[model samples]
Target: MKEKIKKACAIWNPIAGNVRRNEKNIDLAIDFFKQKGYEIVKKATVGPLTATQIARDAAYNGAEYIIAIGGDGTINEVLNGMHDTNAILGIVPMGTANLLARQINIPTNTVKALKSLDNVDIQEVSLGKANDRYFILMTGIGFDGYIISKITSNLKTKYGKLAFAYHATIESFLYSYPVFSMKINGRELTSAFAIVALSKEYGGLFSLTPKANLQSEQFQVCIFHKRGPFTFWKYFISALFRMHDKLPDVTLEYADTIEVYSEEKVWSQIDGELFTQLPVKISIVPKGLKLLVPRTAKHSFPTYKESR
Candidate 1:
């Protein structure tokens, strides 16, 4: 543990709203690590894919631990940069809805989270590979993707939680259903919406795929075939209640891989960033990412039974 803690890279996204507001918090985190006798190389990502390039360079320079100091989107970029490397990953989770960090029970308090890293229990989490890029959370298409497209950084910075709701409201009025072609575990179907998830949670708190596990090799792909204003509410309710599979218009499949296409070009978003457009091929890489989680933390799961 001491050897692994010697040299580390702190990959920071200075422009991330949460991080930007809590600059002093992160500075204390840096000081705390330095006090613990770790040689920390601070790298701030300037723009798009900057986090990835910085992480790749840090890894190449023999950084044993790559610590992410931004949101899940930042972590996603770092994962793509790692690309099959055997380096341990750590997280400080300074972002809107740090789903990955929350899943592993890492507190959002920058200093506390960094201190927890010393006693981390390393675990292997699954990675969703699209084309060649990696996504730490779920991949979205259709209405949700369109909603993401509507969210601007300025709006997110101004409104916070209401930003998504506002963007969704606008999207609901202006956007029509997207025509999708999907292949799940060999069967082909056309749908208006699709979500292929590697983690159990979506949109921070929603348990869209409650039974899904990040450490598991399988991916849960939920497809909604219905189109209309009510269709969004129906699916949204199911996701809100963690009953996505039971939605009347929804079909759920568990497979190692899935492919998605569309008659017209449809945009896709992964871990909050606008990703490649369809036709996309998504595959689950079992135990691909080595994540540093709290020693006492458990993977996020659904509370179905009264007693565990």
Candidate 2:
């Protein structure tokens, strides 16, 4: 009897991030998986939400593995397209802020990232749900979200990380920092900025929620109790040094569910995409997705054993 050939769907975003070199390796990636005895379906995104549709199509067609070859936002779309399929998720991290990839120890270099897949294993990881959508990274409410809402594709691709900083700096001075409320653990707390994190990496720079873990089915809610440009800058410096949690107005708590609201219109960024209009509900979905993680990322997953 002949064995069945497994199917793998490799999805890539041609225009995501600074992918001049990474885009060239699309063929290499497909061949890499092909050599692994898998039939590969290579697709590129034409615009927004295309990846999701492709992923859903692949899942329904019985693909065993769905590899995301773009950034976090692309990965998030692929994830959303996925339903209750037994397919495992993989990443090739090619974006300006590959925070999700960085947190999971996935290499930024496309060649190295593909090579690293040789020593990988599968793990069912927890995912965060913001309203009806799912996120592998944190949900940024207020400051960061405001920046995301204003960022353009050309600006992001050209300026890269500086694009966000540009908006963040300019808006910090002009915009009024409004205080919002989030209900966690049956308690209502007020804050200017809030981070509901599953992974420690925020904005692909610093660990905004150092205690947050992707493997855990809980969120490390980091809230800034004060509102203002001064407080924002202060918290920025403190978080940079990984000491913001020690500050007076900054507080970090763990929760499974969170409801954020405000009389003022608020913006949010989920895995780097702009999510505007507040009153968003966030909660943890335990063991929601099966992820193909490298052995090098064992530190991020404490309970991860070298089963392979």
Candidate 3:
């Protein structure tokens, strides 16, 4: 563990939800590392400047380790910043939910998560790419995107997990589904809802794609062809329990690349942040990024299971 404590850069998001680490805590973390003769470069994220940019600069400046100090969104940005680069990425779960951290067994306690960094295990992980953007968790279209777009950040901060459910329920009632065409690995199809997952944990620790593996070289693609608002609930339930793979209305496939075309623009989200609309091309970069996991953390793999 001592040998692993080389020069590391800690990139922190100052406005990550409701995390309340005071000046003392930061000082303690910094001091602890410094006493061990580690050169810790602390950089706080300012408004609008993505963590990826900060991470890129850190790597370009020769930082061997890049620690992301926020929620999944922050980690996603950091990952994007260091994409295609051979740099080690670490996480401190400071934002709401910290789904990625939980999945990797990183302690939510800032001190312990930081201490565990000494024994951080490096794992090559897969990422989902939409156009030039990379998603660390999952990407959604159709009804899922509609629900995401409807949820306000203030509400999410105030209500935490319930915010998504509250907004999803309202969107279910008010938002209408859009018919679209999808092509998975060059096979043509149509669907109103689609989920391309790279990891098992969706937004609130729920598994949207039970068989999705972060280390796998493929993406788990789920497309719901049924149209109309009534059909939204059916797919929603399937996604919740990750039992949607075997439904007659669901088309589940594993692929390295997928192209989505729509009669009109389709909404999309990656790692909970809403991005551009589709006619978008999505793909998985197999073992593209090296991530830091706790020493005790064991990576989970997917197995085929019959969904009734």
Candidate 4:
């Protein structure tokens, strides 16, 4: 007896970073899947949120798997479309920063990423929700959110990840660091910046929230208590050293719900994309997404009730 072929839709964004190179890699990935007996359906996104629409259509059309073939932003868009459906999520890291891919132990190398698909395993992961939008990795308020708002497509296309660093440096001196209040799990808290993180990794291999687990039903909220240039640099240095959690002004807590409000309107970012303004409620949706991960990846399995 032979196994049945699974249907997969590859979602690619032509305007994503490293377009020419990524397109070649995407072709290779598509060919590989086809050779393995997968019924490949190729879909190229035309504009913002187009990947979401394509993925939604693919899911409705009964695609067994929906593969996002760009960076984290592209993956985020595809996730929004597929979250309400039963199609499994697949990723090919071809973007500037494949944060979620790295978090799940997916290789950055295109060939390696495709090869690992031979032993793919499916696992359910929790997602963070802010009103109607769902985020798989992290959400930011204040500083990081403002940075996302400042990033332009041209800057991102030219400098890639360095665009963030460049903008952050300029924003530190020019942009006002606003204070925001959070009602985290019923307790009131104030911070200059806050990150509600579901994944342990941030900005590639760096771990901003070391204890964060995607399989867990809760989020690790890191609050930066101080404001100003010196404090920002201090926190940046600590995060670079992977010791941000040890700083006195930085507080980490586990919560399933958080409500954020600002006296003055402030920006918010979900998975590196500018989402909405403050005065939003965020909560966890446990086992909300099914991801296709490497079979050998330990964290791909559910870790219910496990600390950290």
Q: In TM-score terms, which candidate is top?
A: 2
Residue-level error in angstroms, candidate 1, position 179: 1.7
Task: Give the alpha carbon lDDT tens digit for every residue of 1-308 in model 3.
Answer: 55666777887776565454444565666676677666889988775446888889888888887878777777888988887777888777878778787777777777887787666557778888998899877888877677667667667666766877777777777776778887776679888878788777777645667677887888887778897656777777766776777689887788888888787867988887777788788888877888877666653533222211
Q: Which of 2 and 3 is ahead in TM-score?
A: 2
Instruction: Report how far residue 195 has shifted in candidate 4, in Å.
Output: 0.5
For model 1, residues 1-308, the per-residue Cα lDDT tens digits are 54545688888888675888888877877787787677898889888898998888888888877888888888988888775787778888888778887777787777667766667666777888888789878888777777767777777656665788887766765677878888877788889888888777777758777667776688887778888777777777877877877766788878887888987868888987778778888898877878777764653532111111
lDDT per model, in order?
0.78, 0.86, 0.75, 0.86
Error (Å) of candidate 1 at residue 149 is: 1.9
Summarize candidate 2's per-residue lDDT along 3-49 as a digit string, tens digits.
67878999998877856546677788888888877898898988888
After superposition, which runs of candidate 1 have C-alpha atoms over 4 Å from their true positions?
Answer: 1-5, 299-308
Off by over 4 Å in 3: 1-5, 20-37, 115-118, 299-308
Ranking by TM-score: 2, 4, 1, 3
- lDDT by residue (233-290, candidate 4, tens digit) is 8998899998898889999999999999989878999988889998889999998998
User: Model 3: what TM-score?
Assistant: 0.87
Between which residue pairs do clashes occur in model 4? none
When 2 and 4 are scored with TM-score, the better candidate is 2
Per-candidate TM equals: 0.91, 0.96, 0.87, 0.95
